[model samples]
Target: MDKFEQRLDQAARAAWLSYVGGRTQDEIASQLGVSRPGVQRLLALARQEGLVKVRIDHPIATCMMLSQQIGERFGLDFCDVVPVDTGTADSSYQYLAVAGAERLERYIERSAPLTLSLGSGRTVRAMVEALSRLDRPQHRFVSLVGNVARDGSSNRYDGIMVLADKTGGERFLLPAPVVAGSVEEKEAMLGQRLFHAVTDVALKAEAAFIGVGRIDRQAPLFQDHFINEGELDELLAMQAVGELLGWPMTQDGDVIDCSITRRVTSLPLELLRDQQLVALAGGREKAPAILAALRGGWLKGLVTDETAARFILDAES
Candidate 1:
């Protein structure tokens, strides 16, 4: 160690012995081969430099005001609050992902042969990737939304696929575009036995993990070409704050009725209300959308970072 660090360590030890360890200054001085006054000086220096650290750990269980408030405000069943760095959205998602993984793991372990409805998104992908390896052969993971698009593009955030790979769970995905050409095409697709069966199973899930999406210009759905310019403009006109399972919603969390809603193949919000619907999201950009989802009573649970938690709590107050 460097000279200053070495000196600080020795002084800190001396201070700890005197104050925390309950040793008298004379005893500490005798042990250290120094004068009582010298020991006092060392103790003072340690305090001045913040070398003799004392920590009062506030357990996570006790510091759950945000979690409790969220449950009470929205009548939610579960909520997890993860601390975040006030930096990039990626960093915030990282925190949310770990928290989400832990929460998902616990539920999966307890609920055998569980049916978990999944959503495709960057944050959800990160959460699935962070999950510890497990063999959940009896568990089924169902996609909340269609992966493919009309342009032959697809959601790279196919989180259900990732979860199967990571957890060794069975997975089901709809083999169609997320947004179809018209309402007739969407109806025809949903009318098919296979699509109907897939959606029915998703509705019957014991719990669901969904990703919260903001209806902004820079939203992932638009940026990834899942939705085109016209769709974005329509959502903007609808005053859509955010979306869950491809259902656009306003600031108060009410789903907007529009043509785009007609063409999208995703889980229906009405069904989610009966399940343990947990939405994972973070970052300031998604605050309004997250708040709307909670306010709308669309989600039964939430896993999010501290900054977003504070933002939601502040808005409610």
Candidate 2:
């Protein structure tokens, strides 16, 4: 073989042994009958001459790129895009739960006390469940949504209690139904001293994690029986696309001024907007809702999957 060909072959072998075979420089040198420095030079030559190629086998690399693109496009401070699990029919919740738990861990691990607000939904519940148990009694958790439904049953997806249990932190839950019977009832409930006290603490939270719900027949509000069929139809007729913390909004992310909104007992969206609200939602069915929230600037951060992220970016484009 020619001198050039011999050098190239040696470099390729060294590169393969060092990178692909995970061999140390000393080990590679011994195998190739060269000094450790000579092995290093061969590896460097392989890289410089394009004889070695590196590729990440995991999907997180792609997800990170998508996260950056989405963050830049929406002017968000934080964004997490989880890999799409194509094998499963619906893996949005699975991946989002793990990613959301990791995100929450960052705040809970801090030693200083922090007040975190929470919104209820299957996604949020899943996230709480996925979180590892930690003793963070210095922190506090407050629910941004009421714990009760219209039928007097507890909201199944409410996660504040679970979060409190997991973290050993204090808990504050709104002592009213998700939606009151009437505006007068809502006003009376809101005026109560206990409710006022809870909201005061909620308003001062450092950050909040919420879930986005699409407004439709299958909306969480409708499915959970928080809102009746008539209310759902009204929201649909009003061009509502999504909801955050039970406040329905149009495609532009403007909260709809409907009777249902007036009866919603949760903290006002206007107030929540002033806080650092990060939404955890994904799935193709929720892309439009997620887009609306993004466009409306309702979220400072978002944790979603690549499928939904692509849809949101495409819709914005």
Candidate 3:
């Protein structure tokens, strides 16, 4: 072989020994009958010539670039982007939840007395359960929104319950409807001493987990009757596009002042906006809402899947 071909061949063997065979440079040098310094030079050449190219297909590394881009573009502090199977029925929600769980694990590992303001939803529930090996007895998880239905019903997937079950932390749940039937009822609930305790805990939370909610008629909150149809119509009429927790937000990420706002028992956005807020959402349909929240600077972090990240980038571009 020519000198170039011989060098390439030598580089390849050195790389194979060091990488796949997990051999030390000295070991490779002895086996290849070359000096250790010669093995190092060959390894460098392998890398330079792309002969030892190694591409990891892990979700963490793959999403890192996208995460950085989104974080910079939206002025966020942190972002966890995950690879997702867009063809799945849940629209990559499982992957998003897993990613959120991993991020949450990191936050929980920090020195205790950690207070978390949690939003109620299926995604948040999944995230709490996916968080394994966490036992923060000193930390606490408080609900940001009420889980009770207007008709004396309640959400079984309430995040407070799921979080409490997973962690040995204190759980403070606001036992009221997400939206009371009237402003008076909402005020009454908010005025209650029990309600203040939970809301206070949430307001002072060091971190918060929220879900981006779409305004489309297809939203679960609408279909489940948690929010009345007329309120949905009002949101649409007011040019509202989505919601952060239970508060309606415009496409520009501005919270709308509607009757829903007057009646929602959810913690005020003011309390959670500047906290270490991370929104867990995915699916192409939720991209717009997520972007709106990010634009409004309502979140410091985000946990989402690859398809949703791409969708946001595509929309921005």
Candidate that scores best on lDDT: 2
As a whole number from 0 to 100, the lDDT of residue 311 in candidate 1 is 89
TM-score of each: 0.77, 0.79, 0.78
Q: What value does the lDDT take at residue 33 in candidate 1? A: 90
Give me the candidate number with maximum TM-score.
2
lDDT to native, each model: 0.81, 0.87, 0.82
Q: Candidate 1 lDDT, tens digit per residue, 191-247?
A: 889888888889889888889999989877788676889889999998999988788
For each of the candidates, give the backbone clash count: 0, 0, 0
lDDT of 1: 0.81
* Superposition TM-score, candidate 3 onto the true structure: 0.78
- Which residue pairs of candidate 1 clash? none
Of the candidates numbered 1 and 3, which has the greater TM-score value? 3
Model 3: how far residue 134 lies from native, Å: 2.4
